[model samples]
Target: MTFDKNSFSLAGKVALITGGARGIGQFYSIALSKYGADIFVVSASQKGWEDTTQKVEANGQKVAFLQQDITNPDAADDIVAAAVAEFGHLDILINNAGVQLRNDVLDFKDEDWRSVIDVNLNGLYYLSHAAAKVMAKQQHGKIINIGSMQSYRAGKRIFPYTASKHAVMGLTKAYADALAPYHIQVNGLAPGYISTEMTKPLQEDPVRGPEIAAHIPSGDWGQPEQLMGPMVFLASEASDYVTGVMLPVDGGYLLR
Candidate 1:
């Protein structure tokens, strides 16, 4: 059988992306939609997705949005149920919702610590477990977790965020090991200092900005759109054999 890798297309697949309204999630949603997947977006807020919905629709794809906070444990089941109800099945899941709170380690509040971990790590567990149940029964699925460069390095002021990302990679590997038997591929994408709304403040700082740029081997910040190709590869048949790997989309920052 001569294989033409053009089978990499995500056509007819259904993808559910958490935090799909903005930042990297928005980019992932649109990228997948353009690759022929129907997108079901799960977001904490509906206020910002009008443009996202339109963009998906313009790509000749169907899209639905759920405005529910993922921090709610039950939100995971609700979001997956809604997506499966609308699309019949979930072929892909992107756990891309996260937040960061920078504080001096000595001054970090208990609430702040708990909140960051709850959303970044716990929410992913809630959602991934929900999706995995469905995927396992169906015997096929793809999970692409959005990790961070912080997963590898410890910065001065963001302890909780760093801890949460490291936990995310751990969760990715464990899930991949457990789900691989069901043919579900679970993987992580660790982005380094991307130029997004979340990183705008850091990028704009005269001191922090130059310091970060210098640390990256490419000497610049990465763009959210730059992840589209790798996202598609992982979500499609091209990555059928790939699992539990943290693919860094950094500008060679890890090499520094």
Candidate 2:
């Protein structure tokens, strides 16, 4: 039997990406669109929607936008419905929206911790659950959760974000196991020492910056564009046999 040479082609597919209006999520939207998938971007703010729209359109693919915060569990259903309405069906869901807070273990406030978990873990679950329902009925879907190196290791003053990511790892596995029979693939993408706007402070740290760079065998932080290829693989038919796997595009940052 011949295998599909075009397995990576996402033509005619549609993706709903949370936080797709900016940062890494914006890159996700553009990458998928570049690879022939129509994009339905969802975000809490419209700050970057215009730029995202222009990029997606420049790729010659359809693009739609929705302003909805993923943190509202009740709105998850509506978000799913709107995506389906906009594109007829949802083929991929990228749970890339997240939040981070830093404080000493003792100084970390109760609400501060909750805010991190609320967006990173709880919101991801609500949206994934809603998207899985649609995929279950359609008999196929891809859910990519954004995880971090913290999923495997912990650091100071960031316990809440770490906790959320660790839970995200487990949730990815659980969702994979449960959705496999439905032809839905769930996976995690963990980034290590990625140089993005979100991590600008860490990159600029006089002491902490060099410390992390030295530890990364690659001798540098990863860029958002470096992740696009992996994202396309996970979202396309190329990865039909791959599920529950966490792909790291960290430029060997985890090796050290």
Candidate 3:
């Protein structure tokens, strides 16, 4: 067999990205489109998708938008069906939708804990399961679950978020092992402290911001765009042999 230089090209493919309207999800959507994949963006709301749609279209790729709360039990089926209906098939699935709540463990409410788990862990599994069926039928696909720094280490005041992220890594491995026979690759992208809307408060904190940066060997927070290369590689044929791994795009934060 010969290595194709264009293995990273997503031409003629279709990708479904959850929480794709803003933040890191937006970058993932744009990056995949730039590599020649049509995009299907699923978010909690459609209010901010216009820009994402425009950007994907600007890349000469078609895009479809869907608004649904991933926490809803039926959302997985609906999201998968909608993407397939819009594009005729689904080639890549990015489980990027997530939620985080910060509170001391003693003060954390039960509802808040459940909510975080619902969106971050349970919802991702449901969606991945639904997409896996479709990909199995086609005998090829990529599933990239969005993990976080918390996936590997515990963080103060974010117990639920940390737990959910840790579960994501496990899900990636379990799904990868089970789905390997079907030619579907299951993996994860664990991002470090990126400057996204969700993390704006921490980034703008006069003291916390610099303190966090100092810990990172890179000496700065990661920009959303920095994730583009890793996203494209995992979503495309360039990573056909890779599965069940969590690739950290953390600007060397993990090294410390």
Candidate 4:
């Protein structure tokens, strides 16, 4: 078999990334643009959008920034419409928007649990559902769902986060099966203990921090940059035949 490097080029493609502003999301916006995809970033807040825009423009890519909460059911269609209007078509969708909360399973408040599920699960479904309609018409698209280490196993003080991620894996497979015939690929990317602003609390924790590092075979937390390659592969034609798979970019943390 022959491998073609050109298959990985995302030139002339349009990607809509949710939560494509701060932390790890910033890396995704930059990485995808670097590989030649125009970006439509939908962030909950406009805080870091200017920085993300500069990074994307530096790579010679066009990017549109939108500030809206995805948790609202009606916000999905509007978000997709805005992206389509900006870029004309949506070729790839990175479902990178999510939230996490820490609480003892027994002490987890109803509101906190619902909040996590709202953004992590419900909001994801809303946007993916909207994107699916547009992509189905074109008979081609890629959807990458961002998952977590808790997607495979349990995490301390984060039961709701764990529960929502498990559901994301299920939705990934279900969407893949439903959209495969249309040439739409749906997949999940699970990151393990990546060091980022959102994960700072865990990374700096005196107890949970070192405990997590010890579990990873690499013996350290993963960096946001490490996830960039896998994201590009999935978004580009390189993963055209891959679907319904949850790829972990962890440093062998699950091996133990």
Candidate 5:
């Protein structure tokens, strides 16, 4: 019944972001920390997280790191355990870790197909399943899955990535429904053409860059920082009534 801006703050919240060492995931880590959340970063690569950790700590937020291949079946439980041990509880889980390998469906290798699905879809389920248990018991939490524009549109090639994203939406909805009783809100953020390490090559393509930009109403590539607001909203009480929905922070690309 009362309004408080601090209700939007993540103070005392603990968040775990997979693939938090780089790209969009790295931005998620720092942005949440800036809003007063302590951060736990889980990733297969640790090379880039040292800088991310420094930024979070610089913001006066406690941060922790775990190096593990989230595709591994056991990695999810381990991540949740480490986070709970470090912070005593978790209030947010960002399933931002994903892999995209471009290949025509006809030529897509078996391993590429499996690997993309493993990291993007299977790993998400594993991690979400683990975190939901802890959160369900507590009856309060947020699970934000990093979906993609591919979830709604299929571009050329990248069949596996498209398939995985589409599947992610279903998982988001199912979890949202099942966890609603426990007060654990689940949602997805679908980013379109964000300028990040994984997307740099595509954006750099002499032909592709301008072509893609022309379609986006914003007429530019979006930065990771642009996504911070939506991330914080869904993680905070602002979106307590929003769930099982894929909010596209796409500069209107999907409309075109």
Candidate 6:
């Protein structure tokens, strides 16, 4: 086969990104759109999506916003259906919606634990399953799950978040194994500590912040835009032969 550089192009494709209203999810939405894919975003609220929509539109791609909590039992099907309805087809699914609560294990409430698992693991599975059905029919697709540094190592005061991310890696591999025959690529992007609203606490901490950065070989936290290249590669034809793997976009955090 000819090695056309345009193999990275997402022209004529549609992508569904969960938790896409802000933070890392927002970057993923805009980056994918910049490469030629129309975007469908699902978030708990639509309040702050205007900028995301504008960014995608500025890329000359259409964007659709959906206000739905992934934790809702029926939301998976509804989300997939809505994306298909908007663009008439779905080509990529990014399971970027996740939640985390930090508390000492002894003081962690059961409700908080369940909430983390619901959004991070259970909800992701439902959405991936629903999207896989659609992709299977087309016999080609990509499912990119957003994992975390916690996906590989344990972190203090975030037990549930740690557990849920670990499960995400497992699901990525399982889905890849089962869906490969249908030409669907199931993989994950495990981001290291990135500067975002969600990690503001860590960034603000005088001691913890420096300690975290010191451990990273890069000696700095990652920026959201740094993830664009990896995201596009996994979501486009460039990764046709890749599946069942977790690609770390960390600033060499894992190396240490």
* Candidate 1 ranges with C-alpha deviation above 4 Å: 1-5
Worst 10 residues of 5 by lDDT: 1-10
Q: What TM-score does model 6 achieve against the real structure? A: 0.98
Indicate the TM-score of model 2. Answer: 0.97
Model 5: per-residue lDDT, tens digit, 1-256?
3458976889999999998878888889988999999999998877777799789999999989998999876888988999999999999999998988887668879899899999999999999999999999999999999999999988578988999999999999999999999999999999988887777888889999999999999799999899999999999887888889989999999898
TM-score of each: 0.97, 0.97, 0.97, 0.97, 0.97, 0.98
In order, the Cα lDDT scores of the candidates are 0.91, 0.91, 0.93, 0.92, 0.91, 0.94
Better of 3 and 5 by lDDT: 3
- Model 4 is weakest, by summed lDDT over 10 consecutive residues, at 1-10
**Model 6 ranges with Cα > 4 A deviation:** none
User: Cα lDDT for residue 38, model 1?
Assistant: 96
Compared with the true structure, what per-residue lDDT tens digits does model 2 show for residues 1-256?
2358688889999999989989998899999999899998888889898899899999999999888877775889999999999889999999999888889988889999888999999999999999999999999999999999898888688889999999999999999999999999999999878888878998899999999999888688888898898999999998999999888777787776
Q: Highest lDDT: which candidate? A: 6
- Cα lDDT, model 4, residue 137: 98
Candidate 4 residue 86 C-alpha distance from true site, Å: 0.7
Q: Residue-wise lDDT of candidate 4 within 1-256, one digit each (tens)?
A: 2469888899999999998888888899899999999999998889888888889999999999998999876999999999999989999999998888887768889999999999999999989999999999999999999998889997779888999999999999999999999999999999988887767987889998899889999798989999999999999888999999999999998899
lDDT of 2 at 97: 91
Which of the two, 1 or 5, has more lDDT?
A: 5
